[model samples]
Target: AFKLNYSFEGISRTKPEQNLSGSSKKLTKDVLLQKTHEERRKRQEQRLKLQSAELLQSHIRSYIVRKHKKDQERQLFDEIETTAGIQVILSKLLFFYYPKEDRERLLRIAERLLNIQADVIQQINADKSFAWLIKRFLLLCLKNTKDNQDSMVLMKCLYVFTVDAHTFSYLVSKDYYGHLKRLLESSNNYLQETIVLIQKPFKFIHESDYLSNLVLSEFCTNFLIPSLTHNVKHILVPYIRNQRKEFPFEKLIRYLNTGFHFGKSHSLLYCTLELEPDDYEPNSDSIQVLSKLSANLYELKPTCDLTVEDSDDEEEEDPVSTEKRLLLSEYLKILNRSDKVRKWINFFLKHNHDESVLMAFTNLCHNLLLVYKDSMRKYLLLYKFGLSSTYLKRLWAYLNKNNTGQFETKISSFIAWREYHTTLSVFCDMFTFYTETLTDSETSDTSHTFTQNDLLSMSKLLKNVARGLIEVAFPMCRSSSIPSTPEVQHLYRACLNCVRMLYTLDLRKKFCPSGFWTSDKMHIPPDLARKDYLSKKISSFYGARNEEDEHLPPLSTIEQRSLAILEELPFLVNFNTRFLLLRDLCRNSLGEDDYQRLHHDLMHENVVAIRRTHIYEDAFDKISQKS
Candidate 1:
């Protein structure tokens, strides 16, 4: 059991086991202190490394951000100095009304600012309050300057912004289009560019709304109607296809379907808003030639003025060379090659032959009709071959023949009829001109007048033109009733006038004393006829020029044929009303005051109708004045 050993100083003596335990406790405490100190030192070193890394990273990040900022600033400064530069320093100084002593410098800077119109606009937008000031300065500079380069630049910039989808509304709100229109009037050459700009915004806005309606109205009346020469299908068709809402295409079609009236209305209706292109009639010599013809037609050569040499020259040269003339078929084939026109035609065919498409084609044909007579030959040939429907008919038959009423076939038929009508009018004009020229031979020397061959050639041309017109007009007449519509009535009236003119010319040729030499009843004296045997032979040849009998029956015989033609034509409901008006005018001509007053009233009414039909006449005048 246990006994304890003790030392004499009242201190207890430790046993061997206790001594060992005390040493062990001291060693354990020392080891624990060492471990804790090591742990604390390692933790301190780790925290210092982490702090240093974080500081270095932050510095690098700050340097990168600053470098990027400096680079951006430098790039912007470079841009500011380039051709499309900002010139912000000059702008700000001008805005603050800096000294008058540096007026020259300021003016130079202002000019630069004006030169870069788009840049100036950007600068203006950057500081909204400065817009008015900048704009005023620009206006003042424009007013004081005569050079148009700056003005054109300004217009170009505005147009550029107007076509941008993001900026269109802002530009419109700022009346950029209005300003462009004003500038356009001042400068006549930018019409095409203006139209392009005007059409660009349409693609983005095709819905029903007030803005869209306004845009449409402006496009139709101001841009479309006024620009007669350009084909708008390219500019408008794509947008129309995309649009969900119905546009005013029907209204436009109805208006264009009507015939053009004469006088100022004709001039206005034919006004082309397109700028003269570089390739357009570059030869100035054509004008001189045309003027010479006009002068010669009005000039009266004295009798016995014809020298033998002059007669020889006239005989050698036909005076009218038909070289370089494109036939209608050739012209149409060339037109068909145009990618845009082909696409439009294909689009129409795919769309089930819409009337608007037909109208567009007719309008194109109408413009072709208005071309100079040399070009008129192209249309004539086109009617003969290109639109003969043989090629198109076969093409349709090969394709879905069930879709017989495709665009090509329909447009060809319409164009054929239109060309025939136009050609008939041309024939009537030529016939009248020849008749008058021949009749004038009695007053002038006969030797200098038109030869029998010339007269025969003219007659033959007229007969051919008449044959085509009748072929087209008769079938159309048979299909429709007489005078079914005003358009049809107008065609009937034109045909009637043509017939009357031809008949009058025929009678004059048969009975006129001037044409006695060519008359069938004239029994030439054998002696004189032998002495002038060459002249007699020429006269007899012309007299025997009855080759047109098969195609064109005699005009007197044409009476029954015309009656048959009229029977098929649409009946004119307003014919009796017009007859009564005419009767009243006839009575008024006999010094009847009441009838004259009534005639005047009717004339005024007719003028009102003309004004209504020609809506652009008044606007055209205003446009002309502005230009």
Candidate 2:
């Protein structure tokens, strides 16, 4: 504790002077005078040393006091529960609950204990010992709902590992999907965080590993589509759109539970429709990323013909019977927010003429026309000749004539193609909803009469959406030997519904309120156009040569299925939405405006509306309040 600048030699030399009193010093003065004169320099040095020693004593006391206080505080903290020796703590917390933040403190104090080198994180994912810890943490996160006390800490550890691409890709490449699936049981608060963390690596992953992608894709399909969370649809759509099928999907129907609300799933389809070029590029191993991307898209947004009519049990049961539905719906929301929908729609027009694919085209057009019919003339500009020509009756007839009807039957059976039929049903319902809502809203406020512009806008929007949908679905009606049970029914109803809402046959009355098209009969063209598009898509699916090159086709069965599935995306997406939209409309007790309000209410009730993906929150009621 001492702070003396003087050495021990200086202290010893000056010690002799300390015992002397003033009188004793005076007696020695005569004797010391002669000695002092002889050694004046040495006496001066010793005097200075004495003064410095006195100063050192004060500093020594201050140092001792500070050290004592620190030691006492340390002792008290040690006695407290958390700091109960590292050995006991490590043994207790190593499993079930690792305080990642506290572990960080250990590193801060001494880096060598864990022996974690800077390169350790990257290697840990591949290293057997460290990899086990990562897996253990992953499993722990999935043990309970997102709000579990230990869940957040586990997520933090995962986050640290993800900081490096090497570690992250390695972890993801392994079966992290098992843990991801477990998150479905977690509360909404934790679900959001868990999904966000998991989705990070997926943004860059090509899904080269079949087992890995299949497990992950299935997990996502189940969790994303039925989830009530709006964000989920947006998240999963990119994986589904503009691609063929590479992922296993024999259980797709089972996976997409009846609880799925398709109207809200549009964002997913849109996202699937848009393709990312980087995803299409080959990986370092020269594996084609496009095939995987395409396959996932097909599974996500199928245009092929297929349907799963609700069995007695499914029809009788409530969709909200379990938590799985909510999770799937949430995933769908994430997919929808992306551009996957349009990508699949465009792909169908180019590849197949299946009715389901046709329906998807109609559905996509319906969405666009409803939202942007003001630019119909401009839409016509974007509409390619290839798409239009495929729909043209003469062109459709020419294509079908070449087919012997065998391909037609089998092609028609494809689920993606069949989904187009469902799409028409969905739009019919949406149009119905829109009309009812507009009518009620217009009339509800009785004091305010329906304005001329409001009526025209409503009429125009409805008619345009119907016409756009018909342009894609009507051709199938013309081509059908036996008209579709619901596809044609919905298609006809949709067109008729528009007329009913508009209170006019001249469809231009909706767009041009002046009735200019009435005299010219311009509305016929849109109706005829719908019939042409439907016929062409149907003929294409049945008749088009699926082989881009018979000699060098898809490298594997997966690639072929993916390509085939993608060919049917437009229809699958459209039909699925239609089925959901119809079911919802039929089930809804409310009228149009009330129905809209109810839809709004349901979405607003979702807890993840504002929070991060994996942020687990209070139960349903508390989440609803926050939303």
Candidate 3:
């Protein structure tokens, strides 16, 4: 019984130990679970904080962008307000000062106001008082202004105001139409200014209201067209001739065509040209009319002179003089047409009296020759009418007489010099045409061919022209001489170009004879020839002589004269042309040493940088190699 009791005690003690170990393990597992929950809560808080920070940054960025845009808009509004305020103040001051004859202040104000015309025009439309002040001031200035300067200022102000549609409408409503019309009529003395004023309103035509269109039509019929008709020669002709930027011919035609009354009859008045009739052909009747007009223009004296009473009776009989005017206008129009000009020129060339008439004809032909160029070539060729030589002879004779002081007025000298220049230019054109025709004949089947007689005549004419030009015009081409007047300078340059062209043509050997370069009347001095021979021998010894020197003849007058002209008047020919001339002379008249010396001098003397490679040089080299 005692043994059984001890075993039960041992079993009970072991059971208690096992229960304590289980309790310890359960306590450790509970602590691990608490630690894991704490870690998960910390991670959630971190993630929420990161999202909040990004949201805050994006909101702040958007707020900044909105603020920047608002600030820029506000700044722009303030600038615009300030500009508008400045324009108003300037306009007010301009109005206040203009009536007091403050010309200087007015000009300063007008110029400043003109620069901001956009704002000023806007103000003129929005503010009735401002518009009234500007309109009244402009009218007063236009009405009372006697000074050209004041008129120009007023014109600028009016031009600016008229270009804006609203301001133009406002001005028209306030009796400005009559004042503007009167302003145009009164300002006829200032043709260009009147034109400027007249053209501005036309710019608004497409976008203009009906009243504005009516006003523009009135301005055109009552003022613009009439003034243009009366002064077409004085104003429109010069404008067209000069190619002025102020008013172009095409724009004027378009403006005139906008008028309801503008027809083919009025077309002649504006452009001094007529619509080419669809059925109109170049017939003998038209030629006869042109020939009659030419006879009248070239007549030294009128066929009959009418007394005052007779003239009145004739005027009463003719009433409008429409036929005479139409005939004269047609004559003037034909002078500009290349196709008709040939016939006109032929008629003019047939008659030869009166220096003034000849001068006019020469000028006309020169312009035609210049403008028509190769188109008029066949009519003026050497073998054809020989008109170029005829014109040149007449001009030279007139010039010779003028040189003797027979006609020494400033106007006479002016016309004579111009005639001479034009004659030379005409000759150059003809010669170029001739050479081109010759080249074309060789390459293609051309109808016109030059004969030996034509060549001989051309060469003789060239020699005479060259000699005369060198003696008369080239003396002024010297660099050391005092600078000549523009007229003289123009004449000199024309002469130089003509001579150079002639020399170039002469080199072909078809136009000029072999002996043309040599003159029997001119002989070189012994000393100069000997010096030249010795220098050439030395050059040959020093390996400076080229194979081209073996068969070269002695220098002649023509060669000497050409060389002297080129050497003495270097300023006349540009470097490239001079270089080519020298090269040609080297191959023909000059020795190799002379060419090298001149070439070296040319290279050194020129101020502009010379390109080492040239198209001309390449072409010349190719031609030389091919030959």
lDDT of 2 by residue, 1-627 (tens): 988796455444544555454454344667878887869888888999998998899799987986676555544544543546433333233332434434443222223212443454565545666555544443343333245554565565555545444444455545565466556354455655665665555433344444334444544554543433443444334443322244322222222332232334432333332323324321211111111122222123222222555455454434443343343334345334434435443565554545534443444343333322231222332233112433332222322343343222222452444433334333334434444453344333101323455445444444443433333333333354334433343344554454464453222123344443232222111121221122222222123333333443222322222222223322222344435444544444357797788678878785655555445332333333223
TM-score of each: 0.27, 0.31, 0.28
Model 3, position 39: C-alpha lDDT score: 99
- Model 3 TM-score is 0.28
Model 2 regions more than 4 Å off = 1-126, 142-145, 148-151, 162-195, 230-390, 393-395, 398-484, 488-627
Clashing pairs in 1: 328-378, 328-381, 328-382, 481-569, 481-570, 482-569, 482-570, 482-571, 483-570, 483-571
Instruction: Using lDDT, give the best candidate's number.
Output: 3
Q: Worst ten-residue run, lDDT, model 3?
A: 535-544
Candidate with top TM-score is 2
Name the lDDT of candidate 3: 0.47
Q: How many residue pairs clash in each candidate?
A: 10, 103, 0
Of 2 and 3, the candidate ahead on TM-score is: 2
* Candidate 3 lDDT tens digits, 1-627: 455444344444434334644554345877989999999999999999999999999999987986676556444544553455654544444434434445554555566667878887787778877776676556544554443545676666776666455555555555554555555445566667654554555455456556555655454455434423444445534443454333333333443334434422332342323322323343333332222223223212112332235543543545244444554344445454655455545654665455655655545444333322133543332223233445545554554454432322232243555555555555554445445554444532111333455445544554454444444432322432323443344344444454554455444434566556344233223333222332342110011234344555554334444444444333333455555544454444567787788779988995876776563242322444235
